[model samples]
Target: MTSIVSVRDLKKSYAGGFEALSGVNLEIEKGEILALLGPNGAGKTTLISTICGISIPTSGTVRVGGHDVVTDFRAARNLIGLVPQEINLEPFETVMNTVRFSRGLFGKPRNDALIDQILKDLSLHDKRDSKIMMLSGGMKRRVLIAKALSHEPSILFLDEPTAGVDVELRKDMWDVVAKLKASGVTIILTTHYIEEAEAIADRVGIISKGSILLVEKKEDLMQRMGKKRLRIELSTPISELPQELADRGLEIAADGNALIHDYDTRSDRTGITALLKDLQNAGLKMTDLETQQSSLEDIFVDLVRETS
Candidate 1:
């Protein structure tokens, strides 16, 4: 798990003395997808821009493949590819030309074979010769990805890659990310869609107010911070929780059709047995039972609340 990109004490400031990033330290491992989740104005884009050498860091260091981004700009930049949130492609330019042009920008020799392969990998081969304006939004996004990979960068940064994409298309983008990772491209993507992070990221990093809240394995984060609920369906509707049930930390659902008992998955004793026994003694009839686990969104919201 070698770090391909490392940020140490990174900070960015404006003339008005507004800090976008504050002493941020992060390590993006080689060949893994790291999803950066944050609200608007959380400095996610600024961090990506600085790492790609599009913006200068006010202080501290960012190393891409051990090359300083500020001092060794070309070398560091050549090893990185960035697909920004906007679809700013030249509408008149053909997709093939657009992607090929990106490769040439890196001083790479003409390698149409490689470019074609990248296009094919992104499922954009059929539209390669079409003008940017002719492609759909999802196809345009795929073209952006192709352009990023055209340079054969070791690290790829996707800033809100699926911003306005449909659900199916977003899933397609996830598949593309998987292929990129399998090919040893280290990906660090910023996403507003929390489920996108949950689906594809090996690790999830939460950033807020210019500082990183936490970075952990997606599963570990969910397990450690996530909660579970026992959804006990009642045979009859109730407007409120009975005194006995309220003491057991059970609450009636909004529709009053069931009761919800929230518990930690990591707990050894969930008190379910006692609760069920208590329910029987209280003359409550259970019609069905179901359980639900907290999603990544739940953990993200809770963390933001605590930090804010």
Candidate 2:
């Protein structure tokens, strides 16, 4: 896929010498879902704002659809749509009217058909005629998505789209996002929901302290960085560590019912068999055993901590 959005050495520094973004570089494909995972002050929003031309970058370049965001602001901005983290809709405007106005702001001709489809896609058709202030928080978020799609932008930026919504509502929004991806809209979302990214994103980018730590395909990242743990349920509780299994470096569960061993999934010699043999020699009996893989949240937290 071709790159629809490109940032090279992007840097943004606010007054008082606070650096919000630090020489960031990224390429967003034309139709892929890229999720930016980061901590609160990790420059996720700053990168998005600079790319959308909302905040002027101290240095570097951002281009959308081959148009320079700084030099060809209108052309670049026209190709993008942003659903910000904040709910900043006009309280009294009808949903349909607000979406229509957003389309008009982009110099797009009136197209009620497109507007209707967007409302329906977001499950906001029933609320189309209702005032924005009369809707629920989740509905307001749907309206924000509707407005972002009003102009039929090739690229969409969702900044914390599911922040305040319930789990069910968040899942509904994920469905909406999946539909958008299927319709060939490139999506770049900044989210605290690591599970959301793990569920939907084609690629994951971790940012910390105003710089990108890593960017890789979701599955590949998990496979490459993921660790595994082997949990052993002992048949009998041991009061102290056995000398025979002392080299295993196992962790005893708080309840004294289980033992935990961490190992790399990619390693050829995980030492599970040897550990089991050692346990048997030490007169220990294992009642049950289970292995678990580390989740995306684990990988994300590890990256952020390493960089911090």
Each candidate's TM vs. the true structure?
Answer: 0.83, 0.84
C-alpha-based local distance difference test score of model 2: 0.91
Q: Give me the displacement of residue 91 in model 1, in angstroms.
A: 1.7
* Tens digit per residue, CA lDDT, model 1, 66-94: 99998898899999999989988999999
Per-residue CA lDDT of model 2 for 7-64, tens digit only, reads 9999999998999998999999999999999989899999999998889989999999
- Count of steric clashes across candidates, in order: 0, 0
Report clash pairs, candidate 1.
none
Please list the C-alpha lDDT of all candidates, in the order they appear. 0.90, 0.91
**Clash total of candidate 1:** 0
TM-score of 2: 0.84
